[model samples]
Target chain A: MTTQAEHRMPTAALPADASGLLPAAEPIRFLDDDGGPAPGDAHGRYQRPATELLRQAYRAMVVGRRFDSQATALTKQGRLAVYPSSRGQEAGEIGAVLALRDTDWLFPTYRDTMALVSRGIDPVEALTLLRGSWHCGYDPTTTRTAPQCTPLATHAPHAVGLAYAARRRGEDTVALALVGDGGTSEGDFHEALNFAAVFHVPVVFLVQNNGYAISVPLSRQTAAPSLAHKGVGYGVRGERVDGNDPVAVLAVLGDAVESARAGGGPVLVEAHTYRVEPHTNADDDTRYRDHDEVEMWKRRDPIARLEAHLRTAGELTDDDVSAAREAAEAFADDVRTRLGEEATGDPADLFAHVYAEPTAQLREQARWLAEELAHEHGAGEAR
Target chain B: MTLTMGKALNAALRDALREDDSVVVFGEDVGPLGGVFRVTDGLTAEFGEERCFDTPLAESGIVGLALGMAMNGFRPVVEMQFDAFAYPAFEQLASHVAKMRNRTRGAVGLPMVIRVPYAGGIGGVEHHSDSSEAYYAHTPGLKVVTPATVADAYSLLREAIADPDPVVFMEAKKLYWSKDETGLPVRTAPFGTAEVRRAGSDATLLAYGPTLPVALQAAEAAAGDGRQLEVIDLRTLVPFDDETVAASVRRTGRCVVVAEASGFASVSAEIAARVQERCFHSLWAPVLRVTGWDIPYPPPVLEKYHLPGVDRVLDTVDRLQWDDAPDSRFLSGAAT
Candidate 1:
């Protein structure tokens, strides 16, 4: 019998059906605009989850979008240093993150706050990094999520090593590291892929194809037809999914995660999507990207498509949709309040964690700071 | 009594593996062929493949996997085949191995050792002959150590394996076969201490790695005359043996720092600053440095001019003498 891994690999390239014309095919969508399954659904490996899980996924996507928008506003208002908005790609993050078991580890890049939130990270904690309160907002061991590595694709090898460790320890947990298309060009990405393939480690490299690395477009990044196909050279399974369709992403990722947990080695999942906003608050995409292309992707907004599908399916009423929006707004407000109320970190915290037991030199430095602070306080009291 | 640096390292690895079951040796070509330098010769045969095994060609993978093993309570000794090859693994070194203990708030400890054979003496091309100690020294959590003698070769390797933090043990590639006729030490040496090779009154010569021999040769040349020169070998760079360095410079009143790395912002530069700060009252002259030029290591034919040598060391000493300043003609000639 053919296994799930066999079914996941792309069977055929894009086809031309008509004799007279090659129509601009609607980019692959698992759920149509009317909340019905799309035509020629080929992923036979995964079964749809219960209706509750689907609703939860929808809620998560909404919350992720709300958090992304709030974070962008904070950056614009000068409260946050910078923010990488996940406004257009929430379905891709929510779908894949919701599919994984809590025991599995996540290695996310700077653009993966949506995935972190879907995996139960507090939105305030996630924004703490953007607010510049701490380099890493939360303890990774406590969250089972590594700090968002900003250096393009450097975290891939780290995730592969973690997966290798889990397999060695006989743990069923797998590791999923998320990176952008531009990261695929880095040597660490190739090293990670080669290592995962050679060792048969349970890792799923989730590449969010956002089309540009700052000003450099995907065309300049590689000649490969798609990032997913690059995995073929390493003897691992690769697939492209409708990143805007939560159901499709969930189905593909669920199968991949289960296959990995069962010792089926690694899979490379390329989420074909577009970055609706600039790379970050610091970037201005209007300079590089044609306005027409951005308008074209706006029609494929993940939130709009998913909301339309849910309303048509009678699974979510108009009132229910409005309630979801209101709940997300409230949650974002709560995050804003918490961010303002939390105590600022001490400057001495910089020297606190350089070593397990601070060395003599570090100790001396810490003492000097303490004395400096004490003298300042004394002067203030005397005045 | 005669032992090459490679043989000393081999003996040290064998002894560590025999003494502790926690010790495991790994790297590319380290198992069947006993490593590219043969520093791991006879290890696979003696300790079995499980304890001494070959890994894939990926250096980052080697270090990351060793880190995982270290987290699981294994004392892994990983070797990078060459100095340039270690860059691919620097992320793992700088990110996880060095910072994991602090990142986890002391819940985790990485007792791993990364052995890199570094520096140019033999005719190694550009990538093969870099002095990357400064890179490791710049990283906060990792300890950096280099050995220049057979005793240090035998003792420091064992000590690095036993240290609580990750240690970058840089072995000079050129000295792998340099033989020491003197006997090896009977006991293992402690980490974070400097070894004083000679006692002198005028000046101290501080060096490590392959340059330690150069400093000793310079000391011997100076001693041939009435001038006495002290020679110090800093076995460890981080948690640097500042006490020994300070005491030596205080007694000698002058110092000439030396290393194979380029002069600008080198470990030698740091040593000079620290010595000046701690021993300022006793110092008669500013600490001078006889170091590699601030350029990429030159081609083999021009390497003698790039690397600090006996002549350069003597020239620096001649500049430091207070009495020699009166002879304007001789001083001017030397200066020109």
Candidate 2:
């Protein structure tokens, strides 16, 4: 555990060329392909997460995958405007959420609806942004989760500020900001890391390097040795984990979150994962990537691998697997029923909440809209 | 009992920090440097590093940090140092800071103020002088306010920090040292109301921030010629006080907008359109605008020709046709 004194000292005051701050050369892994344990001491640095946590992550991933696919179907049925499937990257998605406490804040991106689902947010509230109902359906203050941010890397500094403020208020709250491989190229990401390091704030940046940001591949995103290695220059400890392995991802991310909570400065964890589906329902993956690469990643599916691991260890039974699938189907069916109806919102809602006290300008506009609506209704009655 | 605009603003920030432990002041050079213009002078000494501190020289990071801090229950007052330097933070202000409350359906509100020392006059070099208020005023969910008097600087900033929404507080750089004989803790008209600084009936000279003083000087100059030009200071641009302005314009029968920003889709243009729409029958002539030409800010040496001053304000007032006679010099012979 990092001492309190160590956490208070800025990185500039620390010794130069500290090896403890560097990332591992290879991505840390415990479970290998085909769900077999990896040979040798590949995961010796960090202890494996509790078995109960792994089981929970597995069940949540199953449900999360169902929710993601259902969301995609909803987009096709015109219930949602768009849905980004977190299909093959379930390990990273579930592990990151499972690593933190409910009090800890999660700053997810637009593509991180699966993480929101794992956080126990109502699935319908999670899909509101894509359904064109509201910008954010859930109250961030109550859920301790920011709106699924759309802009890349903009929320990174927000996490730093919240974590820093919590520290000042003597709260043990940590903030986890999730970013994609492409988001790391943004200037806000650099500033966030640097500010967190300088202030020694309790924040964690999880970069799910899913190989593609829209159509651009990881190779085009950065020339750095690894996205995690980009943290050393900012005085942040960096770690890389096999994102397909739930065991490794949970352990690494859990360790990072705890270290930060214990007052160790912010750490960046890059999970090597793949976007098994197109970037979103609106994207065409065939225009950029090849089919062979997709097939290779499909063999290493996070859900299938975790299920195999659990069964091999006698932790999960056929009955448990079937029960989980049944629950997921029920959840999906409820979502379909709720989203089937057309959303009916008051037109006056457009003028509400622009400010604590609605401005006179907005009041005038609202009056104009009211008149126009009344005219339309009256004309319809005459017709 | 006298104070400069810079000192008044500093007092406002200091008072805010003392009043609420949740208020924090931060930005590049805001710590020991006390800001380049010294508007944040002595704040760090009074409040300590936790309340007022220096940040990395990244504008976007500064604003983004303020947003997060505001979300965590701290009222952050950040400085952009200059007008043009704030461009880097435009995305954060537009995408997140400005839309946080509305996007969350009022679940979250950022009670913060972004203090920018704006506009030209001191002969600074490149990237120093710019009138970027129109960009912020055009954005919804943000209150764009600029104070022309020392007393307003103190009261408006204090009110802005206490407001339950994000505010872009533009501080006129040239007016920092402009002294007022009034004391601190003075109260002006509430926000969203325009003050007729110099009331008259001949014509109305609408201005805000850096151009208010210029408009007042033009009013004084027109008074010397036996014409009474009403000078109106539009303190807040977003929640614009159209009632106050329309009333004054209806009585005056003519209006001329003066601003340092380039003319061509600007706040000045918006005011002209609104005045015509509200007081169309009251107006005796078309609303005129005296603003910087539609070009990038010129070099410091050449800025005198670009910024609207007393002479320029009067020049536009001439087009009002006081005697109901068209000036042939401004008319095209082909039309005649």
Candidate 3:
């Protein structure tokens, strides 16, 4: 997926300042397109995770795929208001999120349900925002996770701010911020990167180059050599990785997270992935992209490739595959039952969180609304 | 101690940094150049580069960093080089910073201050002067305040920085060097509390920030015409001190809101609407407003005519009719 037509890796000119990120000549790769080990010596720097961890990672990836498909089906059945499927980019989602320590924070965007789920958030609660209900559906402080922001690149700066603040207050916590290709063009992205670079804040930024921001292609996003190289301008080091290869993504993100945790400053890792499905269930991707082009990417599916690797290694039995499938089915069944229940959106909840102390105006407005709602019901109830 | 508004602000920042370890001061050239208006002058020399420093010329970046730092427990006091330059960071301010605490259900509150030098009259170029309090006052999570006195600049800024929520402090560029030599009065009220700069009984004139001086001047001019005008300096716009304003209007039975922001759908409009609702019985005339025309800040030569001057305030009050003509909406049986 990190091909020439889309990402033309350009040479960055620089004076090598005290803290500029050194660009990797090529995106770090650990696996071939067919799931076989690729030629690279970079992985030799650190010990690979235990075999059991790899198995768990594989299961998590499978679960991520199941969630994506189930959520898409829910959207079709009107169970979910909308869903932005991380269908083809599950590797980038699972790999980056799993690398973070429990104490660290995860800043996800609207399309990052997989990342949130991997953090132990309940599936139904995770979809509350996507389901178009109340504000972000979970307690961020308890989970150390920020609400999935819809505005592009807006949360990136928050990640940098929190990280910088943590460092100043003598806390040891890193922030892992995720954004898409199109989000990289936003001014907030530039600012966050620049701030992270200058302040040496502990943050790991992963830009999932998913080929399109809605209908606009990557070429129209920027004329840079690659999205990773954009970090060089902010004095941040850049690492490009094959986003379709979960193994490669895990290794690269793991290294970056550790580097940040050890106070090596922030790192920008650009994962070359694809959005196999449309931007959202409401979008008609066929209007902009061709089926033939999408077919070429199907060969690089993160889930199928990893499953093929486990089979090739003789680590997978027929029973193991059947057990994973059954688990996914049971999870989906539970989701369907939960969503089948009625949703009671209380009107008073709107005034609950507007301020730490609701202002006089908001209080008055709330009182008026209560009176109006009461009056509408035949004025039978006393105020 | 006697000081200019600029000097008072500088002293306030110095005291804030010294008092709080988490308090940080930064902006473009704010460290080395002391800011264009010298508002943040000499902060770095006393606090060092770690606590006070400069950032890249990206408005969005400056604000984004402050937002994050504030979330993580730093009291970031950021500076926008000019009023118009703040447009780029509007998204960050309106989006994430303003909504984070509310979204988190108050698990965390942002104790940050974004200092903006705003309004026109100093013959500065375009974008150098603008009235942005309305934009921020319109946002829910932010606390918007502006100080019209040298003493208020010192006290209000200290209070804004010390507050637990994000504060948008709009410092008037034109009022920075005014020769008002006075310290905070002993009985001075808190930051959001309104100050009755001058008391009268004919009509109430409400103003804030740079326009407070004009409102007071309009009051003096009205007295020459044998009219007693009460002028209240609305120290803060968001927490809008309605008790003070309503009481004055009830006594005078008239009101005229003054601001440098455009007339249509502005803070002035909000004040006008609220005054009518609260003082409907006491009012003998409809609430009036004297503000900048619905247009952009023109060239330096044309700014005088654009900003709300004393003449405009007096003229608006002069035309306020008190013929005891019942409001059209309350005419006879129409109000039944």
Candidate 4:
């Protein structure tokens, strides 16, 4: 429960280079790339939670990376129809999701399986969607996490709507909606931002500026210098953070979440990161981006950076690191086994949850399908 | 009652607002000005600005906010101003408002009604005069209702407001000023029931919204020609009044469905399918649909050619007439 006064600054007095984007050689860093503390850096702003909290964030990211990698492999193996890997943008997902309370809602795009993991959604459930067996993997109300939306930026308005609802109900909940840099090109993004700002809705627009939108560079996405600056036009407070630094992301997101929960309205956070992997299983990034550029982003690996910081801080050891990796592998294996072993969903399941009270037409269709399936597979085969 | 369909709707909304403090009406220009159509005239004065309010110009925001209010335990009835204006709110309607209950496993019920003034007859341009009910009916979670008569305009609105799920209440803009005899009790019409405007044995003319009157007129003209056509007005599109439709089609053995929506995948298509499936043996002719052309709704002057009219209905009836061809399957009681 941080007060607005503690976080507020006079609009005119704030430093123009607070974000450390350009003209300033001094980059914003608390823990350097080698994981050692940068003396006199904004360490106060980087408020560390319990050791377990940091460990949980690291563990989630590791597992998310594994799930992302394996799912891509599955797609290549034809077990999955498609997979959108959040390979390079793990910190953006993990940091923001880690800051969210269970009561808060998450509106994620298709590539945000990492955020879904942090929200307590089982990886298998997300895989079920990529496998094309289910439309939505989990009920949103039960988990406070909406199903991944494929239509770019459409879910933005929904998140705003939900946050408006929460605000009206006087709930201390916030909605964090994840979108790619490319989604900023959509009118829905602007509409959602404008609506959220005007309504004073408690929503966080987390834009993972991964530099490319399915091969389209960020330069082509918008004419604006930075996505965060777009928020100023809508009268929302905006911040840009290094997406590779999980600590900085966590700090900035925690501040945004607190501000939103305290009735300060919505904020736009642009996590400047790069996508290390191709857009999806179907894409080949070699055509659009050079190997040198990929290598440069790879050096700023969110996981490697965070691991280095933790090791230098004496919060993690080699055995602990080995155990975390082992655990992530085990989790991925478990998910793979569950997905591979699980039976294909019954077609009747489609009609089952359409409505709590099934319509007469739906019932008829379900019955017809059941009878048809039974006929095809012999008696009593359809459920 | 000498009231326009719009007046009836406003009266119905006013009554609902008077009856419950939880009932709130919101849309663009719904307050102060009482809407562009003046359907909601004098409501702001009657209920005050809090209960009857104007929302921002954003259609999706209006619907989305109404959904939030509904989830927060308020009954919100939103107006789309016109049929075409609802497209901006389609995502909210399709993704959230309609599916909220099912998505949340019934933990929440979106008790909101979106009033869309649809259909053609008025000299509205293309976007304003579109019949978009088929789009809504195609969506699974929404209950779509279109009122043809003034009494229906009053009663069906009350029913839509009280329904647990989100309901799309489409009013034929052309019928907004059209009045009907009043004195019917304002009660909840069951969701899946069709009202028989006129019952006959020769052929069943199925219609709804503005086309209902055309069907009734067509039935009357056919009656003079020795063909007693049954006229059935389908009130609800989703959870369709299959019983009423099937009963009429079973007796008449011939059916012609009319709607202002495009001919392809119109509500008439659904009626045609139900009739073919349920009364397959009773059918003597293929269920013909008299609907708007597949092209975009024509300009007002050319709308007569696009929209189904009494002449079109009569032409369809003549095409199916047994007297025109004594060996016609329509009279021979043979399935085509």
Question: What C-alpha lDDT values do all the predictions have?
Answer: 0.80, 0.90, 0.83, 0.80
Higher DockQ: candidate 1 or 3?
Answer: 3
lDDT of 3 by residue, B100-158 (tens): 77776677678889999999889988788788788999998888989999888888899
Q: What tens digits encode model 3's per-residue C-alpha lDDT throughout A23-139?
A: 566667666788887677644444555556566678888888888898999899887888999999988889877898898899999999888887888887788887767667888
Query: TM-score of predicted model 2?
Result: 0.97
**Residue-wise C-alpha lDDT for candidate 2, range A294-380, written one tens digit per residue:** 999999888888899999999989998998899889888988899998965677878898888889999999999999999999999
lDDT per residue for candidate 4 within A3-77, as digits (tens), equals 222222112232244343221123235555555565685444446556676777788788888878888877766
- In order of DockQ, best first, we have 2, 3, 1, 4
All candidates: interface RMSD = 5.8, 3.3, 6.3, 5.1
Estimate the TM-score of every prediction.
Answer: 0.87, 0.97, 0.92, 0.87
Q: Which lDDT tens digits does candidate 2 get at residues B31-122?
A: 87899988889988887777888887899989988999899988999999999999999999999999999888999999999998888888
Q: How far off is model 1, as Cα RMSD?
A: 5.8
Q: For model 1 chain A, give the 10-residue run with minimal summed lDDT.
A: A1-10
In order, how many clashes per candidate? 0, 0, 4, 0
Model 2 misplaced stretches (Cα beyond 4 Å): A1-15, B326-336
lDDT of 1 by residue, B1-336 (tens): 899989988988898888887788888999979998999999999977667877768898788768755754568899999998999899889887888776555656788899999999888877888888999998999889999987788888888887888999999988898888656544545777888988888899999998998998999999887789999999889768888999999998989998999989888888889899999999877788988888988888888888889989988877775663543434456856
Candidate 3 displacement at residue B321 in angstroms: 1.7
For model 1 the local lDDT of residue A24 reads: 14
Task: Identify the leading candidate in terms of lDDT.
Answer: 2
**Cα lDDT of model 2 overall?**
0.90
lDDT of predicted model 1: 0.80
* Clashing residue pairs found in predicted model 2: none
Clashing pairs in 3: A21-A236, A21-A237, A161-B68, A161-B69
For residue A105, what is the lDDT in candidate 1? Answer: 79
Ten-residue stretch with the least lDDT total in model 3 chain A: A1-10
